[model samples]
Target: MSSPTTPVRRRCTLVAPGSDERKIAKALESAADEVVLDLEDAVTSARKDEARALVCRTIRELRTGRSISVRVNGLGTEWARDDLRTVGALDGVGIVLPKVDTADDLITADRLLAELGSTARLQALVETPQGVRSIDEICSATGRLEAVVIGYADLGAALGRVGGYTAERWLHVQDRILIAARAAGIQAIDGPHLSILDDAGFRAAAQWTRDLGFDGKWVIHPGQIDATTEIFTPTSAAVEHARRVLDAMAEAETTGAGAAQLDGHMLDEAVAVAARRVLAQTGG
Candidate 1:
Protein backbone atom coordinates (compact mmCIF):
# COMPACT_ATOMS: atom_id res chain seq x y z
CA MET A 1 0.00 0.00 0.00
CA SER A 2 1.12 3.54 -0.74
CA SER A 3 1.41 6.18 1.99
CA PRO A 4 -1.04 9.05 1.84
CA THR A 5 0.39 12.29 0.58
CA THR A 6 -0.13 15.76 2.04
CA PRO A 7 -2.29 18.18 0.11
CA VAL A 8 -0.62 21.06 -1.67
CA ARG A 9 -3.05 23.29 0.15
CA ARG A 10 -5.87 22.51 2.57
CA ARG A 11 -9.52 23.64 2.84
CA CYS A 12 -9.76 25.84 5.94
CA THR A 13 -9.46 29.63 5.70
CA LEU A 14 -10.15 30.93 9.20
CA VAL A 15 -6.73 31.95 10.50
CA ALA A 16 -6.19 30.51 14.00
CA PRO A 17 -2.64 30.08 15.22
CA GLY A 18 -2.65 29.07 18.87
CA SER A 19 -0.17 30.33 21.44
CA ASP A 20 2.68 28.03 22.57
CA GLU A 21 4.37 25.34 20.47
CA ARG A 22 2.20 22.27 20.96
CA LYS A 23 -1.17 23.87 20.39
CA ILE A 24 0.07 25.99 17.52
CA ALA A 25 1.41 22.93 15.71
CA LYS A 26 -1.84 21.12 16.36
CA ALA A 27 -3.78 24.00 14.76
CA LEU A 28 -1.47 24.03 11.76
CA GLU A 29 -2.49 20.43 11.14
CA SER A 30 -6.16 21.03 11.92
CA ALA A 31 -6.88 23.22 8.82
CA ALA A 32 -6.71 26.99 8.97
CA ASP A 33 -6.05 28.65 5.61
CA GLU A 34 -3.37 30.49 7.50
CA VAL A 35 -2.32 30.38 11.16
CA VAL A 36 -1.06 33.63 12.62
CA LEU A 37 1.37 32.84 15.41
CA ASP A 38 0.25 35.83 17.41
CA LEU A 39 3.02 37.73 19.16
CA GLU A 40 1.07 40.83 19.95
CA ASP A 41 -2.08 40.69 22.10
CA ALA A 42 -1.88 36.96 22.74
CA VAL A 43 1.67 37.19 24.07
CA THR A 44 2.09 39.16 27.24
CA SER A 45 4.88 41.74 27.66
CA ALA A 46 7.06 39.45 29.78
CA ARG A 47 7.03 36.56 27.30
CA LYS A 48 7.53 38.55 24.11
CA ASP A 49 11.04 37.29 23.44
CA GLU A 50 10.07 33.69 24.11
CA ALA A 51 7.16 33.88 21.70
CA ARG A 52 9.39 35.59 19.16
CA ALA A 53 11.95 32.79 19.22
CA LEU A 54 9.34 30.10 19.14
CA VAL A 55 7.66 31.68 16.11
CA CYS A 56 10.93 32.16 14.24
CA ARG A 57 11.81 28.48 14.69
CA THR A 58 8.29 27.39 13.81
CA ILE A 59 8.67 29.24 10.52
CA ARG A 60 11.62 26.99 9.74
CA GLU A 61 10.01 23.74 10.95
CA LEU A 62 6.20 23.71 10.54
CA ARG A 63 4.61 21.39 7.96
CA THR A 64 3.50 22.88 4.69
CA GLY A 65 -0.28 23.41 4.40
CA ARG A 66 -1.70 26.62 5.83
CA SER A 67 0.31 29.84 5.52
CA ILE A 68 2.13 30.94 8.73
CA SER A 69 1.76 34.51 9.94
CA VAL A 70 2.99 36.30 13.06
CA ARG A 71 1.30 39.37 14.52
CA VAL A 72 4.20 41.34 15.97
CA ASN A 73 3.72 44.06 18.56
CA GLY A 74 3.06 47.62 17.40
CA LEU A 75 5.77 49.99 16.21
CA GLY A 76 7.78 52.09 18.72
CA THR A 77 7.92 49.18 21.14
CA GLU A 78 11.27 47.48 21.90
CA TRP A 79 9.77 44.05 21.41
CA ALA A 80 8.21 45.06 18.12
CA ARG A 81 11.57 45.94 16.62
CA ASP A 82 13.23 42.74 17.82
CA ASP A 83 10.25 40.69 16.76
CA LEU A 84 10.41 42.19 13.28
CA ARG A 85 14.18 41.79 13.12
CA THR A 86 13.99 38.11 14.07
CA VAL A 87 10.98 37.05 11.97
CA GLY A 88 12.02 39.21 9.04
CA ALA A 89 15.33 37.32 8.90
CA LEU A 90 13.52 34.03 8.38
CA ASP A 91 11.89 32.80 5.19
CA GLY A 92 8.11 32.04 4.85
CA VAL A 93 7.02 34.68 7.37
CA GLY A 94 3.91 35.57 5.32
CA ILE A 95 2.73 38.82 6.99
CA VAL A 96 3.57 40.92 10.09
CA LEU A 97 2.27 44.32 11.13
CA PRO A 98 1.06 46.35 14.07
CA LYS A 99 -2.51 47.42 14.80
CA VAL A 100 -2.90 50.14 12.22
CA ASP A 101 -4.46 53.52 13.11
CA THR A 102 -3.88 55.76 10.12
CA ALA A 103 -2.34 55.80 6.67
CA ASP A 104 0.82 57.02 8.33
CA ASP A 105 0.81 53.98 10.59
CA LEU A 106 0.51 51.54 7.70
CA ILE A 107 2.98 53.44 5.48
CA THR A 108 5.56 53.62 8.27
CA ALA A 109 5.14 49.94 9.09
CA ASP A 110 5.42 48.98 5.40
CA ARG A 111 8.66 50.93 5.15
CA LEU A 112 10.05 49.41 8.35
CA LEU A 113 9.26 45.94 7.05
CA ALA A 114 10.99 46.72 3.78
CA GLU A 115 13.98 48.13 5.61
CA LEU A 116 14.24 44.85 7.45
CA GLY A 117 14.59 43.18 4.00
CA SER A 118 11.16 41.59 4.27
CA THR A 119 8.97 40.90 1.27
CA ALA A 120 6.17 39.57 3.47
CA ARG A 121 2.67 40.68 2.40
CA LEU A 122 1.07 43.13 4.82
CA GLN A 123 -2.20 42.82 6.80
CA ALA A 124 -3.46 45.92 8.61
CA LEU A 125 -5.85 45.91 11.54
CA VAL A 126 -8.84 48.22 11.19
CA GLU A 127 -9.50 48.20 14.93
CA THR A 128 -9.66 51.76 16.24
CA PRO A 129 -11.90 54.74 15.53
CA GLN A 130 -8.81 56.37 14.08
CA GLY A 131 -8.10 53.28 12.00
CA VAL A 132 -11.64 53.12 10.65
CA ARG A 133 -11.62 56.86 10.04
CA SER A 134 -8.62 56.49 7.79
CA ILE A 135 -9.79 53.33 6.10
CA ASP A 136 -9.37 54.75 2.60
CA GLU A 137 -5.83 55.89 3.24
CA ILE A 138 -4.89 52.67 4.98
CA CYS A 139 -6.42 50.61 2.18
CA SER A 140 -4.56 52.70 -0.36
CA ALA A 141 -1.31 52.74 1.64
CA THR A 142 0.67 50.35 -0.54
CA GLY A 143 0.16 47.65 -3.13
CA ARG A 144 2.00 45.33 -0.75
CA LEU A 145 -0.96 45.60 1.63
CA GLU A 146 -2.82 42.38 0.82
CA ALA A 147 -5.41 42.16 3.63
CA VAL A 148 -7.26 44.22 6.26
CA VAL A 149 -8.59 42.40 9.34
CA ILE A 150 -11.52 44.16 11.02
CA GLY A 151 -10.62 44.22 14.72
CA TYR A 152 -13.97 44.02 16.52
CA ALA A 153 -12.72 43.86 20.11
CA ASP A 154 -10.38 46.77 19.61
CA LEU A 155 -13.06 48.72 17.79
CA GLY A 156 -15.40 48.04 20.72
CA ALA A 157 -12.65 49.20 23.09
CA ALA A 158 -12.19 52.42 21.15
CA LEU A 159 -15.95 52.81 21.23
CA GLY A 160 -15.60 52.76 25.06
CA ARG A 161 -17.57 49.57 25.54
CA VAL A 162 -16.94 45.96 26.33
CA GLY A 163 -17.76 44.37 23.02
CA GLY A 164 -20.23 41.78 21.89
CA TYR A 165 -22.31 41.70 18.80
CA THR A 166 -24.97 44.38 18.63
CA ALA A 167 -26.01 43.36 15.15
CA GLU A 168 -27.45 46.66 14.00
CA ARG A 169 -24.37 48.70 14.93
CA TRP A 170 -21.39 46.39 14.55
CA LEU A 171 -22.69 44.97 11.29
CA HIS A 172 -22.74 48.45 9.79
CA VAL A 173 -19.12 49.02 10.75
CA GLN A 174 -18.17 45.58 9.51
CA ASP A 175 -19.79 46.32 6.14
CA ARG A 176 -17.76 49.49 5.80
CA ILE A 177 -14.56 47.61 6.53
CA LEU A 178 -15.48 44.81 4.15
CA ILE A 179 -16.33 47.28 1.38
CA ALA A 180 -13.04 49.08 1.90
CA ALA A 181 -11.12 45.83 1.67
CA ARG A 182 -13.08 44.73 -1.41
CA ALA A 183 -12.59 48.12 -2.98
CA ALA A 184 -8.87 47.69 -2.47
CA GLY A 185 -9.08 44.11 -3.80
CA ILE A 186 -7.71 42.71 -0.55
CA GLN A 187 -8.98 39.89 1.62
CA ALA A 188 -10.97 40.72 4.79
CA ILE A 189 -10.71 38.53 7.90
CA ASP A 190 -13.18 39.67 10.58
CA GLY A 191 -11.67 39.75 14.07
CA PRO A 192 -11.83 36.79 16.45
CA HIS A 193 -14.66 36.20 18.89
CA LEU A 194 -13.39 37.01 22.41
CA SER A 195 -16.32 35.13 23.92
CA ILE A 196 -15.14 31.53 24.17
CA LEU A 197 -18.13 30.23 26.14
CA ASP A 198 -20.81 31.85 24.01
CA ASP A 199 -20.59 29.43 21.12
CA ALA A 200 -24.06 30.48 20.00
CA GLY A 201 -22.98 34.08 19.59
CA PHE A 202 -19.75 33.04 17.93
CA ARG A 203 -21.50 30.81 15.37
CA ALA A 204 -24.13 33.40 14.58
CA ALA A 205 -21.49 36.09 14.21
CA ALA A 206 -19.43 33.89 11.92
CA GLN A 207 -22.43 33.15 9.70
CA TRP A 208 -23.35 36.84 9.56
CA THR A 209 -19.79 37.73 8.63
CA ARG A 210 -19.68 35.20 5.82
CA ASP A 211 -22.87 36.72 4.47
CA LEU A 212 -21.26 40.16 4.66
CA GLY A 213 -18.74 39.28 1.88
CA PHE A 214 -15.74 38.73 4.15
CA ASP A 215 -13.31 36.17 2.78
CA GLY A 216 -12.74 34.80 6.28
CA LYS A 217 -12.73 35.51 10.03
CA TRP A 218 -10.09 35.18 12.74
CA VAL A 219 -10.27 32.32 15.27
CA ILE A 220 -9.03 32.60 18.85
CA HIS A 221 -10.31 29.40 20.40
CA PRO A 222 -9.86 26.06 18.62
CA GLY A 223 -13.48 25.43 19.51
CA GLN A 224 -14.38 28.31 17.22
CA ILE A 225 -12.80 26.56 14.22
CA ASP A 226 -15.70 24.13 13.79
CA ALA A 227 -18.21 26.97 13.52
CA THR A 228 -15.86 28.85 11.25
CA THR A 229 -15.45 25.86 8.98
CA GLU A 230 -19.11 24.90 9.04
CA ILE A 231 -20.44 28.36 8.33
CA PHE A 232 -17.89 29.01 5.64
CA THR A 233 -17.95 25.73 3.76
CA PRO A 234 -20.12 25.71 0.63
CA THR A 235 -22.77 23.02 1.03
CA SER A 236 -23.04 19.85 -1.10
CA ALA A 237 -26.52 20.75 -2.28
CA ALA A 238 -25.35 24.16 -3.39
CA VAL A 239 -22.41 22.64 -5.21
CA GLU A 240 -24.62 20.17 -7.09
CA HIS A 241 -27.05 22.90 -8.07
CA ALA A 242 -24.24 25.10 -9.29
CA ARG A 243 -22.95 22.30 -11.44
CA ARG A 244 -26.40 21.75 -12.91
CA VAL A 245 -26.92 25.43 -13.60
CA LEU A 246 -23.65 25.85 -15.41
CA ASP A 247 -23.94 22.61 -17.26
CA ALA A 248 -27.51 23.28 -18.38
CA MET A 249 -26.72 26.83 -19.45
CA ALA A 250 -23.67 25.69 -21.37
CA GLU A 251 -25.84 23.25 -23.31
CA ALA A 252 -28.38 26.00 -24.05
CA GLU A 253 -25.60 28.47 -25.09
CA THR A 254 -27.14 31.44 -23.25
CA THR A 255 -26.21 33.62 -20.30
CA GLY A 256 -27.74 35.78 -17.56
CA ALA A 257 -30.21 33.06 -16.65
CA GLY A 258 -32.40 34.34 -13.81
CA ALA A 259 -34.84 32.97 -11.23
CA ALA A 260 -36.22 30.39 -13.63
CA GLN A 261 -37.05 26.74 -13.18
CA LEU A 262 -34.28 24.20 -13.00
CA ASP A 263 -35.26 20.57 -12.26
CA GLY A 264 -38.57 22.00 -10.94
CA HIS A 265 -37.05 24.61 -8.57
CA MET A 266 -36.05 28.22 -9.14
CA LEU A 267 -32.41 28.96 -10.04
CA ASP A 268 -30.54 32.12 -10.84
CA GLU A 269 -27.13 33.18 -12.17
CA ALA A 270 -26.32 34.86 -8.88
CA VAL A 271 -26.71 31.62 -6.95
CA ALA A 272 -24.86 29.75 -9.69
CA VAL A 273 -21.76 31.91 -9.43
CA ALA A 274 -21.67 31.37 -5.70
CA ALA A 275 -21.82 27.62 -6.18
CA ARG A 276 -19.08 27.72 -8.79
CA ARG A 277 -16.88 29.63 -6.33
CA VAL A 278 -17.32 26.84 -3.80
CA LEU A 279 -16.23 24.30 -6.37
CA ALA A 280 -13.22 26.44 -7.21
CA GLN A 281 -12.28 26.71 -3.53
CA THR A 282 -12.56 22.95 -3.12
CA GLY A 283 -10.56 22.43 -6.35
CA GLY A 284 -13.49 20.43 -7.71
Candidate 2:
Protein backbone atom coordinates (compact mmCIF):
# COMPACT_ATOMS: atom_id res chain seq x y z
CA MET A 1 0.00 0.00 0.00
CA SER A 2 1.03 3.65 -0.45
CA SER A 3 2.47 5.21 2.65
CA PRO A 4 -0.10 7.35 4.45
CA THR A 5 2.48 10.14 4.83
CA THR A 6 3.05 10.45 1.05
CA PRO A 7 -0.14 10.32 -0.99
CA VAL A 8 -0.27 9.05 -4.60
CA ARG A 9 -2.22 11.26 -6.96
CA ARG A 10 -3.51 9.96 -10.30
CA ARG A 11 -5.53 12.65 -12.05
CA CYS A 12 -4.38 11.07 -15.34
CA THR A 13 -2.68 7.71 -15.59
CA LEU A 14 -1.12 6.99 -18.99
CA VAL A 15 -0.73 3.40 -20.10
CA ALA A 16 2.22 2.49 -22.35
CA PRO A 17 3.26 -0.89 -23.66
CA GLY A 18 6.18 -2.32 -21.77
CA SER A 19 7.59 -3.75 -24.99
CA ASP A 20 7.53 -0.45 -26.89
CA GLU A 21 10.50 1.69 -25.93
CA ARG A 22 9.36 4.58 -28.08
CA LYS A 23 5.89 4.74 -26.58
CA ILE A 24 7.26 4.28 -23.06
CA ALA A 25 9.68 7.14 -23.62
CA LYS A 26 6.87 9.32 -24.92
CA ALA A 27 4.70 8.41 -21.95
CA LEU A 28 7.50 9.30 -19.55
CA GLU A 29 7.64 12.75 -21.11
CA SER A 30 3.89 13.33 -20.84
CA ALA A 31 2.33 15.45 -18.06
CA ALA A 32 0.21 12.52 -16.89
CA ASP A 33 0.19 12.14 -13.11
CA GLU A 34 1.13 8.48 -13.48
CA VAL A 35 2.40 6.15 -16.22
CA VAL A 36 1.54 2.47 -16.27
CA LEU A 37 4.02 0.16 -18.03
CA ASP A 38 1.74 -2.58 -19.30
CA LEU A 39 2.81 -6.20 -19.66
CA GLU A 40 -0.74 -7.45 -20.02
CA ASP A 41 -3.17 -7.04 -22.94
CA ALA A 42 -0.81 -4.68 -24.82
CA VAL A 43 2.11 -7.12 -25.24
CA THR A 44 1.86 -10.31 -27.25
CA SER A 45 2.47 -13.64 -25.55
CA ALA A 46 5.60 -14.26 -27.59
CA ARG A 47 7.16 -11.10 -26.17
CA LYS A 48 5.96 -11.43 -22.57
CA ASP A 49 9.44 -12.27 -21.27
CA GLU A 50 11.02 -9.52 -23.30
CA ALA A 51 8.44 -7.02 -22.10
CA ARG A 52 8.91 -8.06 -18.48
CA ALA A 53 12.68 -7.64 -18.73
CA LEU A 54 12.28 -4.27 -20.42
CA VAL A 55 9.81 -3.08 -17.76
CA CYS A 56 12.16 -4.14 -14.94
CA ARG A 57 15.09 -2.26 -16.46
CA THR A 58 12.94 0.80 -17.10
CA ILE A 59 11.70 0.86 -13.50
CA ARG A 60 15.25 0.51 -12.21
CA GLU A 61 16.50 3.38 -14.36
CA LEU A 62 13.39 5.59 -14.28
CA ARG A 63 13.91 9.29 -13.50
CA THR A 64 10.50 10.47 -14.62
CA GLY A 65 8.75 13.17 -12.59
CA ARG A 66 5.46 11.25 -12.45
CA SER A 67 4.48 8.13 -10.57
CA ILE A 68 5.12 4.73 -12.31
CA SER A 69 3.01 1.57 -12.24
CA VAL A 70 3.25 -1.76 -14.08
CA ARG A 71 0.16 -3.74 -15.05
CA VAL A 72 1.24 -7.34 -14.80
CA ASN A 73 -0.47 -10.33 -16.39
CA GLY A 74 -3.49 -11.83 -14.62
CA LEU A 75 -3.05 -14.11 -11.62
CA GLY A 76 -4.25 -17.13 -13.64
CA THR A 77 -1.64 -16.63 -16.35
CA GLU A 78 1.71 -18.42 -16.46
CA TRP A 79 3.70 -15.19 -16.71
CA ALA A 80 2.13 -13.44 -13.74
CA ARG A 81 4.29 -14.91 -11.00
CA ASP A 82 7.54 -14.00 -12.67
CA ASP A 83 6.21 -10.56 -13.47
CA LEU A 84 5.40 -10.06 -9.79
CA ARG A 85 8.71 -11.58 -8.70
CA THR A 86 10.63 -9.05 -10.73
CA VAL A 87 8.57 -5.85 -10.74
CA GLY A 88 7.18 -6.28 -7.21
CA ALA A 89 10.73 -6.04 -5.87
CA LEU A 90 11.10 -2.47 -7.00
CA ASP A 91 10.47 0.05 -4.22
CA GLY A 92 8.00 2.94 -4.73
CA VAL A 93 6.56 1.47 -7.93
CA GLY A 94 2.85 0.58 -8.15
CA ILE A 95 1.85 -3.00 -9.06
CA VAL A 96 -1.41 -3.10 -10.99
CA LEU A 97 -3.04 -6.52 -10.68
CA PRO A 98 -5.57 -7.14 -13.42
CA LYS A 99 -8.66 -9.37 -13.33
CA VAL A 100 -8.64 -9.29 -9.56
CA ASP A 101 -11.70 -11.42 -8.67
CA THR A 102 -11.50 -11.97 -4.95
CA ALA A 103 -9.96 -10.89 -1.67
CA ASP A 104 -7.78 -13.99 -1.83
CA ASP A 105 -6.16 -12.73 -5.02
CA LEU A 106 -5.00 -9.56 -3.26
CA ILE A 107 -4.00 -11.47 -0.12
CA THR A 108 -1.89 -13.80 -2.25
CA ALA A 109 -0.26 -10.96 -4.15
CA ASP A 110 0.43 -9.13 -0.89
CA ARG A 111 2.14 -12.23 0.53
CA LEU A 112 4.25 -12.62 -2.60
CA LEU A 113 5.40 -9.02 -2.47
CA ALA A 114 6.00 -9.30 1.25
CA GLU A 115 8.22 -12.33 0.62
CA LEU A 116 10.19 -10.35 -1.92
CA GLY A 117 10.68 -7.53 0.61
CA SER A 118 8.99 -5.21 -1.86
CA THR A 119 7.79 -1.74 -0.94
CA ALA A 120 5.65 -1.53 -4.08
CA ARG A 121 1.99 -0.57 -3.70
CA LEU A 122 -0.90 -2.55 -5.22
CA GLN A 123 -3.77 -1.28 -7.36
CA ALA A 124 -6.65 -3.64 -8.14
CA LEU A 125 -7.99 -3.66 -11.71
CA VAL A 126 -11.58 -4.85 -11.28
CA GLU A 127 -12.93 -6.02 -14.65
CA THR A 128 -14.72 -9.29 -14.11
CA PRO A 129 -18.20 -9.94 -12.74
CA GLN A 130 -16.77 -11.77 -9.76
CA GLY A 131 -14.38 -8.92 -9.19
CA VAL A 132 -17.17 -6.37 -9.10
CA ARG A 133 -19.19 -8.51 -6.73
CA SER A 134 -16.16 -8.83 -4.49
CA ILE A 135 -15.03 -5.25 -4.85
CA ASP A 136 -15.53 -4.27 -1.22
CA GLU A 137 -13.73 -7.34 0.07
CA ILE A 138 -10.88 -6.79 -2.36
CA CYS A 139 -10.50 -3.19 -1.21
CA SER A 140 -10.06 -4.31 2.40
CA ALA A 141 -8.08 -7.47 1.60
CA THR A 142 -4.64 -6.05 2.10
CA GLY A 143 -3.03 -2.93 3.47
CA ARG A 144 -0.87 -2.92 0.33
CA LEU A 145 -3.91 -2.02 -1.80
CA GLU A 146 -3.85 1.66 -2.75
CA ALA A 147 -6.40 2.11 -5.49
CA VAL A 148 -9.40 0.37 -7.08
CA VAL A 149 -9.56 0.91 -10.85
CA ILE A 150 -12.63 0.13 -12.91
CA GLY A 151 -11.65 -1.64 -16.17
CA TYR A 152 -14.79 -0.96 -18.18
CA ALA A 153 -13.80 -2.35 -21.58
CA ASP A 154 -12.98 -5.85 -20.41
CA LEU A 155 -15.87 -5.67 -18.00
CA GLY A 156 -18.25 -4.77 -20.82
CA ALA A 157 -16.95 -7.66 -22.90
CA ALA A 158 -17.24 -10.05 -20.01
CA LEU A 159 -20.80 -8.93 -19.41
CA GLY A 160 -21.59 -9.36 -23.14
CA ARG A 161 -22.37 -5.74 -23.81
CA VAL A 162 -22.10 -4.08 -27.23
CA GLY A 163 -22.58 -0.42 -26.86
CA GLY A 164 -21.20 3.07 -27.39
CA TYR A 165 -20.32 5.47 -24.57
CA THR A 166 -23.44 6.05 -22.47
CA ALA A 167 -23.48 7.11 -18.84
CA GLU A 168 -26.61 5.07 -18.20
CA ARG A 169 -24.89 1.94 -19.46
CA TRP A 170 -22.11 2.04 -16.89
CA LEU A 171 -23.75 3.90 -14.05
CA HIS A 172 -24.43 0.89 -11.86
CA VAL A 173 -20.96 -0.60 -11.94
CA GLN A 174 -19.35 2.81 -11.68
CA ASP A 175 -21.34 3.62 -8.59
CA ARG A 176 -20.66 0.19 -7.13
CA ILE A 177 -16.90 0.54 -7.52
CA LEU A 178 -16.89 4.14 -6.34
CA ILE A 179 -18.86 3.35 -3.17
CA ALA A 180 -16.63 0.39 -2.36
CA ALA A 181 -13.46 2.42 -2.90
CA ARG A 182 -14.72 5.21 -0.66
CA ALA A 183 -15.74 2.75 2.01
CA ALA A 184 -12.24 1.27 1.93
CA GLY A 185 -10.64 4.69 2.06
CA ILE A 186 -8.77 4.26 -1.24
CA GLN A 187 -8.66 6.02 -4.59
CA ALA A 188 -11.30 5.26 -7.22
CA ILE A 189 -10.01 5.47 -10.82
CA ASP A 190 -12.20 5.28 -13.90
CA GLY A 191 -11.05 3.22 -16.89
CA PRO A 192 -9.80 4.57 -20.21
CA HIS A 193 -12.17 5.83 -22.86
CA LEU A 194 -11.29 3.56 -25.84
CA SER A 195 -12.17 5.96 -28.64
CA ILE A 196 -8.91 7.87 -28.67
CA LEU A 197 -9.79 10.03 -31.69
CA ASP A 198 -13.10 11.28 -30.30
CA ASP A 199 -11.88 14.19 -28.22
CA ALA A 200 -15.38 15.32 -27.30
CA GLY A 201 -16.41 11.87 -26.12
CA PHE A 202 -13.19 11.52 -24.13
CA ARG A 203 -13.79 14.79 -22.33
CA ALA A 204 -17.39 13.85 -21.66
CA ALA A 205 -16.40 10.55 -20.10
CA ALA A 206 -13.66 12.19 -18.04
CA GLN A 207 -16.11 14.86 -16.87
CA TRP A 208 -18.72 12.25 -16.01
CA THR A 209 -16.27 10.32 -13.88
CA ARG A 210 -14.96 13.45 -12.21
CA ASP A 211 -18.48 14.57 -11.39
CA LEU A 212 -19.19 11.13 -9.96
CA GLY A 213 -16.37 11.61 -7.43
CA PHE A 214 -13.70 9.42 -9.05
CA ASP A 215 -10.23 10.54 -8.07
CA GLY A 216 -8.90 10.13 -11.63
CA LYS A 217 -9.05 8.21 -14.90
CA TRP A 218 -6.83 6.11 -17.17
CA VAL A 219 -5.52 7.37 -20.53
CA ILE A 220 -4.22 4.94 -23.10
CA HIS A 221 -2.46 7.61 -25.18
CA PRO A 222 -0.24 10.49 -24.22
CA GLY A 223 -2.57 12.79 -26.20
CA GLN A 224 -5.30 12.10 -23.62
CA ILE A 225 -3.22 13.04 -20.60
CA ASP A 226 -3.62 16.80 -20.64
CA ALA A 227 -7.39 16.66 -21.15
CA THR A 228 -7.85 14.14 -18.38
CA THR A 229 -5.73 16.22 -16.00
CA GLU A 230 -7.65 19.36 -16.86
CA ILE A 231 -10.95 17.62 -16.34
CA PHE A 232 -9.99 16.19 -12.95
CA THR A 233 -8.01 19.06 -11.46
CA PRO A 234 -9.77 21.70 -9.39
CA THR A 235 -10.29 24.89 -11.39
CA SER A 236 -8.86 28.22 -10.16
CA ALA A 237 -12.35 29.53 -9.46
CA ALA A 238 -13.22 26.39 -7.52
CA VAL A 239 -9.99 26.63 -5.50
CA GLU A 240 -10.63 30.25 -4.66
CA HIS A 241 -14.16 29.49 -3.51
CA ALA A 242 -12.92 26.64 -1.37
CA ARG A 243 -10.36 28.91 0.25
CA ARG A 244 -13.08 31.46 1.02
CA VAL A 245 -15.26 28.77 2.51
CA LEU A 246 -12.42 27.71 4.77
CA ASP A 247 -11.68 31.29 5.77
CA ALA A 248 -15.34 31.93 6.60
CA MET A 249 -15.46 28.81 8.77
CA ALA A 250 -12.30 29.91 10.58
CA GLU A 251 -13.78 33.34 11.22
CA ALA A 252 -16.97 31.77 12.58
CA GLU A 253 -14.88 29.65 14.91
CA THR A 254 -13.12 32.77 16.23
CA THR A 255 -16.56 34.29 16.96
CA GLY A 256 -17.46 31.03 18.84
CA ALA A 257 -20.12 30.10 16.33
CA GLY A 258 -20.40 26.59 14.90
CA ALA A 259 -21.56 27.77 11.48
CA ALA A 260 -20.99 30.71 9.18
CA GLN A 261 -22.51 32.32 6.10
CA LEU A 262 -20.36 32.34 2.97
CA ASP A 263 -21.63 34.15 -0.12
CA GLY A 264 -25.16 33.94 1.31
CA HIS A 265 -24.88 30.18 1.79
CA MET A 266 -24.76 28.63 5.23
CA LEU A 267 -21.45 26.91 5.98
CA ASP A 268 -21.11 24.33 8.72
CA GLU A 269 -18.62 21.65 9.66
CA ALA A 270 -19.80 19.48 6.78
CA VAL A 271 -19.35 22.32 4.31
CA ALA A 272 -15.97 23.11 5.79
CA VAL A 273 -14.91 19.48 5.32
CA ALA A 274 -15.85 19.64 1.66
CA ALA A 275 -13.96 22.91 1.26
CA ARG A 276 -10.91 21.34 2.86
CA ARG A 277 -11.15 18.40 0.46
CA VAL A 278 -11.19 20.77 -2.51
CA LEU A 279 -8.11 22.56 -1.22
CA ALA A 280 -6.37 19.25 -0.53
CA GLN A 281 -7.05 18.02 -4.05
CA THR A 282 -5.27 21.08 -5.51
CA GLY A 283 -2.61 21.14 -2.71
CA GLY A 284 -3.82 24.68 -1.99
lDDT of each: 0.69, 0.87
Lowest summed lDDT across 10 adjacent residues in model 1 is found at: 1-10
lDDT of 1 at 165: 68
- The TM-scores, one per candidate, come to 0.78, 0.91
Q: Against the hidden true structure, what lDDT does model 2 obtain? A: 0.87
lDDT of 1 at 196: 64
Q: What stretches of model 1 exceed 4 Å from their correct place?
A: 1-19, 237-280
How high is the lDDT of residue 214 in model 1?
67
Q: Top model by TM-score, which number?
A: 2
On lDDT, the candidate that comes out on top is 2
lDDT tens readout by residue for model 2, 128-221? 9999999989888988888999898889999998867776689999999998887777889999987775388889888998999898999887
